[model samples]
Target: MRAFREDESRRNAPLTAENATRVREAMRGISFAGTPPHWAELIAENNWMDRLHGVGQSSSRS
Candidate 1:
């Protein structure tokens, strides 16, 4: 997600419509596969369904 971390000035700036579109374009076609990096953490409680589908806990803004 380091790539998603906007520069300090940009992050502090207002999220205008144009900026939102830019973010969407930047994220397009990106996908995560294979083992997660060591810095990743599983925030959700252990569950069977997720395990069955290979889904895992994730943290995100509320």
Candidate 2:
């Protein structure tokens, strides 16, 4: 998403110009090792998942 890329670029802002470009490129190329976890797996692992789920549900209604 554009917003995600923008946020990632902003996070690279503290680095030197070359370092920032490298950081952004590295982040853009992210690939999970092994299979990606499912949403239910995420919910089971994280205590904050309930809070996040509620926020997701609320956002969908709006």
Best-fitting candidate, scored by TM-score: 1
Which ranges in model 1 have alpha carbons more than 4 Å from their true place?
1-10, 42-62
The numbered model that scores best in lDDT is 2
* TM-score per model over all chains: 0.38, 0.28
Tens digits of per-residue lDDT, candidate 2, 1-62, equal 99999999986544455654575588788877986567746555467767756544554454
lDDT per residue as tens, model 1, 1-62: 56566676666555555655576588787889998776555544355456523421221111
Worst 10 residues of 2 by lDDT: 12-21
| Candidate 2 lDDT score at position 52 | 52
Evaluated against the true structure, the overall lDDT of model 2 is 0.63
Give the lowest summed-lDDT range of ten residues in model 1: 53-62
